[model samples]
Target: MLEKHVCVLEGVMVSQDREDFFLLSNCGPKLLEQKGLALGGLGVASINIGLGGKTLVELERPAAYHTTPIFPLIRSDRKRRNKTTYWRRRSCVQDTRIVIAIEPSESDGDELDLPERCRVLKLANSVTYDRMEKSLNQLEKIVLPSSDDTPNDKFLPKLTPLVRVLMGMAQPSEKIPIQELKFFDDTLNASQKEAVRFALECPELPVYMVLQVNTYAHRSDTSTHNHNILERLLALPASQSGTKLKVTRVGHPARVMAHEGVLDATLEVKANRSDQAALAKDVKNELEATLDALSGKGKGAKGKAPRGAERRKMWEEVKALRKEYRQREGGVVRSVLSESQVVLATCHSSGGRQLRDHNFDVVIIDEATQALEAVCWIPIFKAQKLILAGDPMQLPPTILSIDKMKKAKNTGGTPEKSSTTSDKTGGR
Candidate 1:
């Protein structure tokens, strides 16, 4: 806690329209890892209306956009998983303005102990932590470094059967008879076919990665890339498994995700009400500032914010609007999830606690290597069977803090094995 306050808090303050932003040097890895400030993070900030001194005025005044400096690497010629980053924003310390590109700590950090006039309220850095924590709470007593000889009889069957097998629970393997593909292209390579076959037959399976997958891959033609495996497998199960039992692919990344080539309709569900609410509040504050300026109040007037009747009224309206959005999200999610068998979402996008009781027959995670193991369990726990497809060599999950990673190893950060070690129990 003391270290966070020392590092994250001790930065020069820069004033944005609605809230304060702290600018740190590029050389600071800790600051770079946990980047940006949140609007809701602003709890109770007190500012002087007329504190525009020589240097103070400069920090508060708006500046044009600029590029952040690249952190010098130890060996620039060598290959690195991630290259140095630069964001388009203004900065004073020859670096960067904290942007939305990164996420902050797990909990709301300690207060930035600035003078009363300089203090700013910053909410928790990212909703990723909040949602991740929600998922973490549901998982109980999951073990990593699993061995085949470990006693499993004591483990309860709280998760889906396939997920249990994934946890090295020693479930019986079935020989599923193959059926013709209802939708997949018949010319799949031997490895692709066998991978698809194993996914169909087994409870838990880890296969090679599909292909280069990222935000840009979503734009390119799926035929060029091989991300459609999940989509192809979705339809294959209806006929291929011979049970004629309906198979629903839970997460699709690319048309057959690279959504329409083979699979059915796609429902994109993300939790964004909190973000929407934050925007509305900012608008309210801006409107108030505008009103004060128009009513003969000078530039200094904003500092003397009284939050009178008008302010309270605007807040009420924003609260009402936020509540309405929440209601709409619930009904829309419930309706879509109920009807659509094939649901597509990235790691933590599915409504976390909302999916508590619902379990699926199969849960397939495309680009399994891209997500940290802690995040994978959110969807894994909801599955009767689990299938992972990824190439760790192409893209492995990025670790921002080496210290946190080491601490996590001892403190249960990795609740499950990655695709590599997973083969020990999950098999080919």
Candidate 2:
């Protein structure tokens, strides 16, 4: 079943006169002079008020606008005839301030209706124009759905501000929720504790965790600790019900191992292939000829020592051949990514490669506090969820320029520093 989505717009209304106004809980008033109200089929209307037209008044949601509740008249015989029922004011005067709420009478239409008169409430204070503008801007960005459909209402404008007030507002959190794990015996430090918490709390698959250790020594220690924790988790007993957990680490060592294994296997297969004997013989002859040329052997090479330029040329040719062979085969890094369930890489390594249609369920960054905010976005955009773990109070990213650092400090910004040897190595 397709779920129908409803949008609401809410704001405060300030009036100049005390004229009687009929308030509708769902839709805007039947008759009102206001601008920008025709947009989005929302009951919200913008009105210019005060001297010099500086003060602007906006009606919130029409569904929420109403008057004070009045008790039913009592019967002379002590029997009440009319039950207590909320009613909208037919007329309101100038200088009257009230809160308004509105919703769509029907989906995709300018027509709006009141929900209930009992739900409306008159506000004690009117919302300021500046405050309303700010709130409206925020609401437009956060709540409006990006759609191409246009309503036929003449009053409705290009940009429809269909804002819906959720019954229960849910606030967003800066940190990811972490679940406590009992499988590991090692006592976790403060940083480790937080990382574990995030790992457990994260519900998405293919999670990326980034740790930013400033120095090589710290990075080594942190990586080892993280690997150990992950290993312990992987070592847990299999569930009887139906659950499987897989973890893989993708670092320099892992890539090197994969590369070596691939290279060796490829060489062995080619060496044993019967059809490649001619090609092998030709390659060997060329290699021998090149080596002899570099050594100043045979015809032109029979002279004195080989020139520096000749030797360099021969070496470049050999290097090019080796690179060609590697290119023909596959890369260790690519192989590992294809097989691994969880990839653990430095920010540089993660961003260095061009990923095609490769999206992770979550990306976790450790030591995020020390990483440049720009660098963090690389992995962030590739995942559905992101987890950043780092203590900002520790060392900040290394910025090389003193002038830039000073400027950043003055503006209360953490300047990004030059990459260190460790950073370059880990990125690989």
Candidate 3:
């Protein structure tokens, strides 16, 4: 069954007096149809884009009154400035009863003619919403235009206009699953190890993290170092037969390379196990016998040598088997990510638009203090629970300009700085 979601319009409210009735006469029906809504159902005749001013007019035919009130769809002109320029050309529909004010992000300066019991919905980019919400006391709700309530596989692709429309209306879920938090310290003291052990003993999915470093080079190397610990944790239980754990690594080249090394080492260990050792011996013996027979040197061998045709066929079969084995091993490595219970990714890589549909049960961030707030939000948004490990006092985020700080202070805005320490520290 197709799910129905409640839609809400937010942002700057623009109204036109009786003199501007011509602005919305033509586009009202077309715009509503495009967004899969009925204009007449909402009693909307004309619409406008922009901010400021309020003038109401009675409609010829009002919508059928219902217990649940329906608000008008308010669209904003992308090119319109948020401040300074008043009397800007925008479109708005005329409605006499129930004035709907679309409070935009930049409507701080403009006075809104809000209804007595109007709800303020704050629309924001997924990463910026939390920071923006801290300062907004009037906000009754916060909406993420890039997110969806549907499951990851069933959700629409990100950045599509339809996705934006759907997300604007969908309600966000508040339930978060119980999970565990773990810290990975390369050189852990006894107390730290004991703490990790206690955390792991809990009845929940564990989140593992490492320490934060000042520079990207150090952080990348640390990720690699900690991955070794993760490997050991996986290997301890997997030593028993018929047990396996899948893990995915997302990070810089150094971290990935480190993970590959661990994979290779694990494969080697499996190859040398007792059961595999016996199989290897049997195969070696069979191959030796076959070679001896082909050369006419084995006991009770009748033929002088294998015919040229038979020898070629045997070689081809052997090559085919070897190729098949390599392909099977390669497939195991390639399929690890999709089947993995745990996924590891660098902050920048995690924030990629391509990963928008993915959801993690738990997220662990290492060296989080050095990470920009924006970069941190990408992973946080997708996880049910998050565990961050870092010493904020040791390595603060690097800021490039005092002018940006001044501007931020003057405008009461967040500092506009690069989200990664690597950029400021001159590391690729």
How well does each candidate superpose onto the true structure, as a TM-score?
0.46, 0.35, 0.34
lDDT of 3 by residue, 1-428 (tens): 01101010011001111212333454465553454332332332221211111122122235332111123333333356322211211122223232232222222221221111221111112222222222121111223323444335332223322222323643332334335544444587765675466434432223344443445444444445446546765665453576666554543231234355454433223333324244344443444354445445556777465566776665454344333433443333334334567665655445432244577766666665565544454465555545566554544544434454566689989753442122212111
Candidate 3 lDDT at 301 equals 72
- Name the runs in model 3 displaced over 4 angstroms: 1-244, 251-260, 263-335, 353-356, 406-428
> Is 2 or 3 the stronger prediction by TM-score?
2
Give the alpha-carbon lDDT of every model: 0.37, 0.36, 0.38
Task: For candidate 2, write residues 141-193 as lDDT tens digits.
Answer: 33453464333433221221111212123322345553446644466567666
Model 1 deviation from native, Cα RMSD in Å: 14.7
Q: Pick the candidate with the highest TM-score.
A: 1
If candidate 2 were superposed on the true structure by all CA atoms, what would the RMSD be?
Answer: 32.7
Positional deviation of residue 389's Cα in model 2 after best superposition, in angstroms:
1.5
lDDT of 3 at 177: 35
Report the C-alpha displacement of residue 108, candidate 2, in angstroms: 62
User: Which stretches of model 2 miss by more than 4 angstroms?
Assistant: 1-251, 254-324, 331-333, 353-358, 406-428
User: Where does candidate 1 have its weakest 10-residue lDDT segment?
Assistant: 49-58
